[model samples]
Each structure stands twice: as structure tokens, then as C-alpha cells.
Target: MKLFECQNCGQPLYFENTVCESCGHRLGYIPDMNTVSALEPEGDQWRALASSGQLYRFCQNAELDACNWLIPSDHTETHCAACRHNRTIPNLADAENMARYRKLEMAKHHLFYTMIKLKLPLKNRIDDPQGGLAFDFLSDQVDANGNVTTVLTGHDEGLITINVAEADDAEREKRRTQMGEPYRTLLGHFRHEIGHYFWDKIVRDCGEEALEKCRAVFGDEREDYGQALQRHYNTGAPPDWQNNFVSTYATAHPWEDFAETWAHYLHIVDTLETARSFGIKVRPRIKLGHELEAQVDFDPHKANNIDELIENWLPLTYAVNALNRSMGQPDFYPFILSPAVIAKLGYMHELTH
Candidate 1:
């Protein structure tokens, strides 16, 4: 999520930019280099100007406009690092499906960007067919009896399934309101689900010591997940849930608590990195001493401790929330961070490192 610019023209660029607007040069992301670079067409291949003249080809999914990542031309693999993990994509023949799939890819690619930045383990189905990470984008099915079965977004083993409908802003907003969620987005969904994937890989499989530490912070994930969710829906979160949990839904189960907290951990670090990229420093005119002042001058991903991140995050949230209100919009971040929640986030920080 760091800022990128067109190497050819020095024009500002974005994560999804496929072509530099100012210089008219084609663009492709070099995953290993972790940068979006200007490209020069070289017969059937491309020369990455920012990658020491390395020759490459677009990921196979690029033909569908579903990916703009690159692959070395000499490499046998056709897909880029991120798209290679997709086990299933919606039927591209359907125009709506194609559009929705594109939206999903944009979010998924952003998730991978952070994953790569964090050096998290990534094993596509090809790498570990039995338990490697993968994705499935599915559509709702309607029966002849006029019954519609909605596809639920979730993760099982190493496969993450997402309902294509979530890509539609209207449907997503409706679900957010119905579920009483203050914030929800395609990127949030990816981060939350991937949290489950990592819990399996890093916590569950690591060892007894790791499991014990996780249990101490996130509670015993061995609790009955199905029963916990059923009870949660029936009675709802406890009145003082915010004192111990990040969200009402997080109160459903220990596993959920971890996932919800993990997602927020990603939210804080990534947004802080973005703030640093812009050299954002908040110093309100009516400052209450240094409590409200912050300067994102360090790499959030490599922060020495969770407390450091929280200190920097609070000021940014306060500043942005005010800016959002100025435009008559809801707060950019609408949740509070309690000491207990910060502890869980600390666990996530430790685990990622």
C-alpha cells in the first residue's frame, strides 16, 4: 500500500494502474520487486524499466483485465504470484460476473500486497494441493421453485470462498446495514478471511507453545464454533462487549475474536504506512499537549511493538474522522480501541513478526 509513481514520467501512480496516464507508457507490477513500473514493449515481451531491464509477460489473467501483475517471460508459470492462488473464478462469459470478478481481483491483489510485504507464507493449490491457500469466487444459485441460495463468504482449510455479490457496492452496503456493521468492504472481507487462513498456518500448526500463547490472547479456539455462533445470533453480543471485543460479531467465538482483531491489525498498519508515505503529521491548533500529536515516521510493519502502532494510529484516526465529518460523511473509523482489544492486536503484531 505504499505510494508508487510512473518511473518513466514521474507521474503519481496507483496500485491498479495498468498504464501511466501522463507518459502513455504501459505499466505492470513486478511482484518480486514490489513496484509498479513503466514497461516497454519488446516484440512479444516487455522490458521492465524499473527492474533493471528484465523481460517479462503479463499474468495470463491479464487478458481478461482481471490482473496486471507480471511474470518473467522465461518462467514456465503463466500466472503471476497473486492470480496463481485463484482456484476458481466466476464465469467470464457473463458480463456481470466478469465485472464483479475484476472488483474482487483488485481487492485480492491489495491483500496480497500486504501479505508479501509482511513476508507471510503463501502456497497456492499448485504448491500444496492438499492444504495450500486458494480462492473461489461464486454466484448465488436460484432453484426452479424460486428459492435463492446465497453463497456465504468464508474460509475452510486453505480455501477462501467469496460471494460475487459482495463486489457490488449497493449489495455490500445493504448487508453492512442489516448486519449493524459500522465498516465493511471487499478489502476488509479479504483481510478477515485471510486471518483464518493464517491462524491455521501460523498458530494451529506451529507447535504447542504457539498454540498456548494464542489461547492466552484470543481465548481457547477449541470452543464449539457452530454452537457459539448460534448462541451469538440468538442472544446477541453482551452489553459490555466493546470492553473486550473489537466488534459485536467478534463476540461470537474465540476464533472470530482472533480474525476480527487480526483484520484490524492489518487496517492499522497499512493505513499508517499510507499516512507515512504522504508524510502526514497531525498537530491540531488546539492541541491537548502531545496526546493529540503524531508523526508517522517509522515503518509500521516493522514497528518494535504494538503500543507504538496504536500511538501513531489514534492521531491519524482522529484527524481523518474530523475531515470525514467536514464533508458530512460518517467517521472514517468508527470503532474504539480498548486495552483488551489492543492486547489482542499485540498478539497479531507478534505473530506476524
Candidate 2:
């Protein structure tokens, strides 16, 4: 994430900030500009400080202490861009639910940020003809209400259901260990689930020719998803899977492989952007987009055709891993991208432009 500043006082601000500490200015993110700015009171609502002509209202959920985004009060859609996608939210009165919901909201915001940056269309189920891009932050077995049971995070159609338990550190860690996965987080879950949403909306429904190319790279997605998931749990992933798959789950089906690769692409691009913002040099005179495209040329000893991104990412991940060790925490990034994975990433990069 990029560092934000208070427009009034030039004080450093975080993405989640509602009020600037130094200047006490009210802040709201402008999705159209991908910026956070101070807001000035305008009659019953607020106006962007940069341009008083543009008006916005703090999301109603924000007033209820559940959101931090802004919306045009007179607009037909009442919910803010991020909040509109919520299909189910836990009982707000419940304290545990409030905490978990907050974490889920944070992850959701990040997902929206990335999606907007990629220029992807984001329509909620309510607005779409086929119920695309919906979310369900649900209470599960871990937080059982003497009724419904939840096992894991998953995607159905365009609806992404995330178990609220994943927001709890201990609960999430237990599941992480149980699954033998190196890395797992709320943001990662959002990215992975959205991958499924995009795959259906963009790739599958694009055209038959595009679908054929998608199958060529990710494999035919005609396999019965439920059966594949059941077999994966019963027999586990095949041996020598690491040679071809990005994650064990990816081996379950072609749809999963695409989702896993899509999530990894988001991870790589976001981390590389963070590195760039921090003035951490990776490749000389090479831009981020160019460097990312060049990562397909895998040189074991050095990042040859790849620009500063992969070059900088290698050392950055190592340093982060070492830092986590020093703090007795797990490695931040716990997956390796093989040559085949790099090629997949290249394809994703190609799709972006």
C-alpha cells in the first residue's frame, strides 16, 4: 500500500484513517482518483478539499462505525462502492461479530483497491443481471450459533463466502497449519475468491476462442468441481504436484489453477508497487510494468530479462522472511514461483494491459 498524507497538515495518514491525527481533518477515499483526501463540510454532507465543487457523503455505515468510504448522498445507490457488495454481515450488536466484521471490511477494502487499480468492472449482485461480485462474511463452526457449520473459505458463482473465523488470529493459524499451507490471510482469501469471480465473468463468458486459450494454459475447467474438491480432501494432491501447480488446491481443477495464479499475480504486483513507493531499487531504469512483463525469462542465478521487480522482490521477500524469524513469526511469503508459474504470471500481466 502507498503511504497517504493529510491534505490539511501534511501529516502521515493510513488508508483506514477517518480523522487525521495531526490536523483533525475528516478523510475519505476518492475511488475515481484512487486518492485519500480531507473533506470539508458541505451543508448536510462533505466535499473534497481538493475540489469543493465535487460533493460526497460519508457512508451511512461509517456513521454507524462500520465503514470509512464516501458516497454521493443523492446518487441512486445508497451504499458506498465497497459496502454495496456485502450480501451478509454478522450481527453488528454482537461484540465478537463487530471485531470480525471490521477485519473483513479491511480485507474487502483492499480487494476493491486492487480491482479498481486494474480497471476491472465491479458491480454488486443487486446491480448485475447474473449476481456478479457479491460477498458473504459469515459466522461458521468456529463461531457456531447452534445452527450453521462452516469449514473453509470458498466461492460460489459470483458470491465469495468468507468464514468470519478467519479474522481471528488463533483460529486462522490453526486452519493454516491444518491445511499445511505456508501463507493465508484475509486479503489473500479475497484475492483468491475474486479470481473465481473474474474467471467466470471475464474469461469463460468472453468468447469460445478466448475460452480455448484459457483452457490451454490453465487446463479444461470441465471437471466436476464438487467431486474434485472431495477427492482432494480424501486422497490429497498428487505426488510431484509442485512441478506444475502453484498450490495444492490449484491441482484440484483448472478453475482453481487460474484462481491461484490470479491471486499470486495480485500478490506480486501489490508487493512490487509497495517496494517501488519505498524507493527500494530493484532494476535500473526499468519501470514496474515493464519489469513485471520481463519476469517470464527465468534465470536461476539472476533475474535476466526481468526488471527491478523480480530482482527487488527476491531480496525483499528474504528480508521479510528473516524479519519474521527474528520476531518468531512465520515467513511472510511462503511460496515459490517456478518457471511455469512465472509464465502464468506473464499471461496475467498480458491480460492486464
Candidate 3:
């Protein structure tokens, strides 16, 4: 993430900031422009400082104490662009549910930011006959009682389900340790699940030719998903899994391989954007159009194209990881992208262009 500032006072601001501390200006995120603008009340509602004619208000869910985004009241959609598609939220009667849901919402916003930056189309599941894109911030076994026995995170069709427990640092850390995953976070979960959503949107929707190519590159996705999942749980990943798959689970199915690669694509792009913000640069050796295209201008707030993105990222990640070692902290980036992974990333890059 890049730094933000108050439009009124030029004071430092954060993505989630509702009020600028230095200038005391009310702030709202404009999704259309991918900007957070300082605002002033116009009569009873809020208007952007740069465009006062556009009427806006904090999300009604915010009034109910659930969201922090702004929305146009005159618009037919009651929820903000981000919140409008929420299919299921945990019961807010329990205080913990609200906090967890808020955290999930924040992560979702970041996910949407990257998706929009890539010019990826986002349609809510409700808007699609097969349920295109939906969210389920759920109460899992870890968060809920009364005979509930459900896993915290999973994606099916277009619905991404997240266990509220994942929002709790301690609980998430414990799961991370148990799962032996090098990296995990709320944002990671969102990116990964959205990967699944996009695979369905892109690969599954594309015609037979694309499906054949995907199967040849990844694997056959026709395997029974439930059986493959059961087998993965029972027997664990294959011994030589690392040679072909981005993750152990990626070996379960071709669809998973696509999702894992998609998530990594987001990770690479976002991290590269952050790196460029800090003035990190890499010496370009080979000149591929796609590689050069990955270079992005470092905007501390808005998103940019994926080209020029990973160029700066490769170096910035190395420097940060070394810096972390100097401080006795774990490496900031712990995963290695093999040549095969790079090929998969290339496929994703093609999708973006």
C-alpha cells in the first residue's frame, strides 16, 4: 500500500481514514476514480472537494456501524459499490462478528482495488445466473457455537467464504503455524479466493480451445473436486509436488493451479507497486515487451498497470528481505518463483493485456 495525504492540509492519511487528523477534513474513497478525497458537508450530505455537484454520503451500513465507505444516495443501489454485493455477513448481534466483518471488508476493498486496477470486470454473484462474485463472511467452528461445524475458508461457484476467526491475529497466526504456510493474512485470503472466482470467469467461460490449452498447461480440471479434496486431506500432496505446482493444493486440480497462479500474480503486482513507492528500481537486463510492461509508476494511492510493476518488485523484495534479516525478523518475501511459475505468471500477464 502507498501513503495517502489529506487533500486539504497535505497531512498523511491512511486508506481507512475517515477523518484527516491534521486538517480534520472528512474523507471518502471514490471508487470510480480509485481515489480517497477530502470532503465537506453540503447541507445534510457530503460532496467531494474537487466536485461538489456529486452528492455522496457515508454508507448506510456505516450508519448501522458496519461499513466505512461512501455511496451516492440517489443511486438505486443502497450499498456502496463494494458492499452492495455482500451476500452474507456474520450475525452482528455478537460484537466480535462486527469487528471481524469490518476487517474482512477492508481486505475486500484492497482486493477490489487491485481487480479494478487490472480492469478486471467485477459482477456480484447475485447479478449472474451462476453466481458470479459474492462473499460470505462466516461464523466458523472457530468463531461460532451451537453445533456449527464448518471450515473457515473456501470458495465455490463465485462465493468466497471466510471464517471470521481469520480476522483475529492470534487465531490466524496459530492456523498459519499449524498449516506450515510461510505467509498468510486476511488480504492473502481475499486475493487467493478471488483467484478462484476469476478462473471460473476467464478459463471456464472461454471456449473449448482455451480450456484445452489450460488443461495442457495446468492439468485436467475434470477430476471430481470433492474426491480430490478428500484425497489431499487423507494422503497429503504428492512427493514431487513442488516440481509442478505453486502449492500443495494446486496439485489437487487444474482449476486450483490457475487460482494459485492468479493469487501470486496479484501478490507480485501489489508488492511491486509498494516497492516502486519507496523508489526501488531494478536494472533491466532482458527486454521483453511484457516484462517492460510490468513496470508501473509508483502512486502512493491509486493503482497502475501490471507492466513495469514486477520490474521494480524483484529488486525491492530482495532489499526488504535482506533488511528484515538485519533486524532479526523473518524474510519479508519467503517464496521462490521457479521458471515454471514465471511461465504461469506470463500467462496471467497476457490476460491483463
> TM-scores of the models, in the given order?
0.98, 0.87, 0.87
lDDT for predicted candidate 1 compared with the true structure = 0.94
**Candidate 2 lDDT by residue in tens digits, 133-199:** 8888877553455665664678888888898889998998898899988788989999999999888
Query: Model 2 — TM-score against the truth?
Result: 0.87
Error of 2 at 113 (Å): 0.4
Order by lDDT, highest first: 1, 2, 3
lDDT of each: 0.94, 0.77, 0.75
How well is each residue in 1-353 modelled by candidate 3, as lDDT tens digits? Answer: 55566778888776788888888898888777667779988888888874557888887677655565777757776788778678888898888887888788888888887887777878886577575688878775543556767765888888888888999989999988887777888998888888888777777788888788777778789989889878887888899777767777677777778888888888887776665555554443556534423333555223343334444555666666878999998888777766676677777777654
Using lDDT as the measure, name the better of candidate 1 and candidate 2. Answer: 1
| Candidate 3 lDDT for residue 216 | 74
Cα deviation in Å at residue 63, candidate 1?
Answer: 1.1
Report the lDDT of model 2 for residue 240: 79
Clashing pairs in 3: 125-133, 293-307, 293-308, 294-307, 294-308, 294-309, 295-307, 295-308, 295-309, 296-308
lDDT (Cα, tens digit) per residue for candidate 1, span 1-353: 78899998899999899999999999999999989999999999999989885799999999999899999998999899999999888888999999999999999999999999999999999989988999999999999999999899999999999999999999999999999999999999999999999999999899999999998887898888999999999999999999999999999998898899999999998999999989999998884847889999999989999999999999999999999999999999999999999999998998999
Query: For residue 8, what is the lDDT in candidate 1?
Result: 89
Sorting all predicted structures by TM-score, with the top scorer first, yields: 1, 2, 3
